[model samples]
Target: MPKLKVIAFDGTEFDLEAESGSTVMENAIKNAVPGIEAECGGACACATCHVYVDPAWSEKVGQPDVMEEDMLDFAYETKPNSRLSCQIKMSDELDGLIVRVPEQQA
Candidate 1:
């Protein structure tokens, strides 16, 4: 399992164990990490699972696809690192991936 670090809006951090093939949003929901709403369940149709990839892990996480980018427009406070968690799959290389949840969902 890869270790995923999720930082909440209030600065709280959750260290979660995630299965390699699962999406970030799925692990977040499983661990009850607050701030990742995941309203569309990893379908890539909603922006509720919006998060900011930490600068250190940005390149490793890569950019979201066109559909995800289009959905991110509905997220709150979109930034250069903004991404839909559903679009990010966990892998061994992402063992220490870190992401920050937005203050609120769209």
Candidate 2:
């Protein structure tokens, strides 16, 4: 399992354990992390699971695909590091992946 760190809008941090190959949004929902609405599950059809990949981890996380990029337009406070958590798969390389939840979802 990879250890993921999720920072809530209010700056609360959650240290979560996530299975490799699972989506970030999945782990978040499973752990009851707030602000990741994931309204469309992991289908990449909604922007509710919006998060900001910590700058230091942005390159490792990579940029979103066309579909995810389009959907992010609907997210709240989209930033240079904004990403749809459902599109980010967990891996050992992401063991310390850090993301910050937006104050609100789409």
Candidate 3:
């Protein structure tokens, strides 16, 4: 399993062991990470699962798909590094990934 580290702007953080097939959002929701509401339950509808990937991990995770990209536009704080967590599938390569929840999401 890969390790995931999700941090919030307020200094709250959750680390969980994740499997390759699970989505980042799933891990967060399962662990009760505050920022990811996942209101749409992994569907690419709600932008409530918005997250900001650390710039260092940006290239490793890549960009959100068209649907996710569109949803991200509605997120609280838009940025080049912003991504909908539902779109990020965990993998060995992404172990130790660090994403930050926005202040609002915190």
Candidate 4:
């Protein structure tokens, strides 16, 4: 399993375990971590799972797909590093992945 260190703009932090195949949103949701709504349930339709990958960890996470890119427009604070958590797969290389949730969703 990989470890994810998901954070929020308000300083909330979640250090949870995740399988290599699951999405970041899935692990966060399962752990009841605040800030990741995943309202679309891992689908690309909603931007509730919007997150900003820490710049230090950005290159390791890679980029989002077209669908995710489109959905991100609905996010509160879309940035160059913004991504839908549902689109990010957990991996050993992402053992310490840091994601920042925005202040609002919807």
Query: What local distance difference test score does each model get?
Result: 0.93, 0.95, 0.87, 0.87
lDDT of candidate 4 over 1-106, digit per residue (tens): 8889888768888888899999999988998877788887997899988888999988889888788888988888789999999999998899988888888876
Best by lDDT: 2
Model 2 ranges off by over 4 Å? none
Q: List the residue pairs that clash in candidate 4.
A: none
Provide the TM-score for each candidate, comma-separated.
0.97, 0.98, 0.94, 0.94
Clashes of 2: 0
Q: lDDT tens digits, residues 23-48, model 2?
A: 99999999899998898988999999
lDDT order of candidates, best first? 2, 1, 3, 4
Native-to-model Cα distance after best TM-score fit, residue 46 in candidate 1, in Å = 0.9
lDDT per residue for candidate 3 within 1-106, as digits (tens), equals 9999999667887989999989989999899888688888988888888888999999999987888888887888788999988899999999999998887641
lDDT of 1 by residue, 1-106 (tens): 9999999999999999999999999999998889888888889988999999999999999988899999998998999999999899999999999999999998
User: Roughly what TM-score does model 2 have, to 2 decimal places?
Assistant: 0.98
**Worst-scoring 10-residue span by lDDT in model 4:** 5-14
Query: 2 or 4, which is superior by TM-score?
Result: 2
List CA RMSD, all candidates.
Answer: 0.7, 0.6, 1.5, 1.0
Q: Give the Cα error of residue 94 in candidate 2, in Å.
A: 0.6
